[model samples]
Target: MADLQVEVMGKDEGVMDDYIGKFTLSVTPGTKEVEIEGTVFKIVMGTFWIKIESTPSQDKHRLQFPYLFDGPIHYSRHYSPAVGLLTNFNDAWLYSTFIKGVPLFFRNNFQLWNRKGPASFAVRPGIQAGHRLLYARAAGNAFGIIEDTKGVVELLHTGAQDDVSGGGGPNAQRRVKPAVYTYIISAEDASFRFSETGAAFFVDFASKHALHSNCAEVVRYSGEFHPRPEGGWQNFGDFTPDDPVKWEFMIDNNSGTYAPDKMLLPEVKELFEFNFPGLVVRALDREDERLVESREACRAYALKWRGVRTDELQLHVREGEVTLCRRVSESGQQEMKRAKDNFT
Candidate 1:
């Protein structure tokens, strides 16, 4: 899990800004994935509380981070969640395939499992077939970045050539230049506030498992973020019609096998289960102030049902502060008691 914080303090001038910061990056054992947690501030705009995770696998890593806004995303007026998600996702993929996967270069000689037969990190790239040399070059071309490969092999071969020829000629031993990974984050506005930043990492491709296929293996996938989920894991944010916070607050209001009339009810169930252990709620049509009268009538026949305990239960409100005059026995309890009474 990788957690990072990019804070925007205040715009200075000419694509630069005064920024405050708190960044943390953590990786769990047995998994190459990184979990990230922190806050991001944009000058006088707003704040972002984000919990992002990069899960590395035997074949590929995945990232579908969560971003929460306390105030507003004025820039949010027009933006593609899919595009933003994919843009971030491309970084993870590039790391696993092109950057981290560079070790395959040395392994190609023996083709030992093609460097991909065994999953090294989470979501490992499939062992590329063909020559490692060709694969490296192709991967570059496929991603429309072959200059990277040339730089990679040139760096390695240059070092070897230098050792042999002792540096001489147009092919004179030039220092091997490795591929570098740089991250650039920026924010701009009409008022002329500009803040752009960058950081870089190096990649070594002297591995043996490298593939040699001129055809770059480019993979593309598409999926939607589920909201108000009917089946399972839901992602809630601005896009969701249901407010994530409110849904979390009222989840205990409904539950069971079938659908609940309130669209937010079902989704709330997920939020509740995620936060609390157990919740018991009574969904009475409080709009009918005569609820007590109806409960009383139901209690009158509680004995006829199946299980009846104390005839009825008192509503607990204000945490022992207020006690109401009317209440109804739990239906489940009434049914069980009634059944036992009949059996007796």
Candidate 2:
């Protein structure tokens, strides 16, 4: 196995004007994973840019283009232990290595998608992950979706929070910002077949929380897209889906809670009906007596129907605990209830 280690430093230096950090990146050719461990020495009141290039020429291009890249890369961060919850300082920084020799492609443009006010919707083309694999996130919650020739499958959902505020102090309400998220797709993914030529790579966005019509607001959205090498990297200009996919959430006022639903706006529904004649969207009602009895069971049922593996789906009915279950049939709502009861 081939291995390479390198040290990375932040761009700026002044104690109060820049970020001082060190990142050690280790690349393992066998597993195709890069492990990054580092420390964030100091961060000033400015955004920091970290770039890793294969050659000096590439580094120069990165400096000039900033957003363009040509290589396999993975980025992840861990809190700094030295900071220990200190304000304005992350404790640590950790990143993963590249996997499968797949070079991650990034879109140079930094665009923001916002839907001005409450009860509104916006549709945009999502990134194409070659094989339907898509990485998406909203307000810090990250998840992946796999949509093959068969249908769409929701991968594991992570960073689920009961309260949108994330349990901050009293000022949390004031600090609340509209959810802004992004998605990435691999241009080489087979899923690009579903996208229009030249506009094959894309990402979609939607606001999770409804804002008052009277309130003035805007949520900034920006991120990079990883394109596969098979097609090289095609710059199709800005992303605009021919048939915009709408993601709607099912919110039951009676329960005062919300969950993703199969509901689609009339126009979006019509577009899907025409484009994907075989597409099926299951409607799950929060008011259903059986579902209300076991929210986890409801989630399990919904996820199973959507092709999520039983082991991949986890439910936490209480604090600091987890429950797992096998697949249940549509007629086995009772079985799900029993599983929930027994587990809890």
Q: lDDT per prediction?
A: 0.22, 0.23
Q: Tens-digit lDDT track for model 2 on 1-344?
A: 22344444443211111223333333322233333343443433233233443433335455555433332322222222221221122111211112221121222311122343222332111111111111111133222222221212111012221221221212211211111111212222201111111111111112211110111122111121111111111211113221232322111212111112223223223322332344432223445553243334333443543344443322112233221111012213554576699999
Give me the overall lDDT of model 1: 0.22
TM-score of each predicted structure versus truth: 0.15, 0.20
- Candidate 2 residues lying further than 4 Å off, grouped into runs, are 1-67, 77-110, 113-115, 118-344
Worst lDDT 10-window in candidate 2? 190-199
Quote model 1's TM-score: 0.15
RMSD of each: 32.9, 21.6
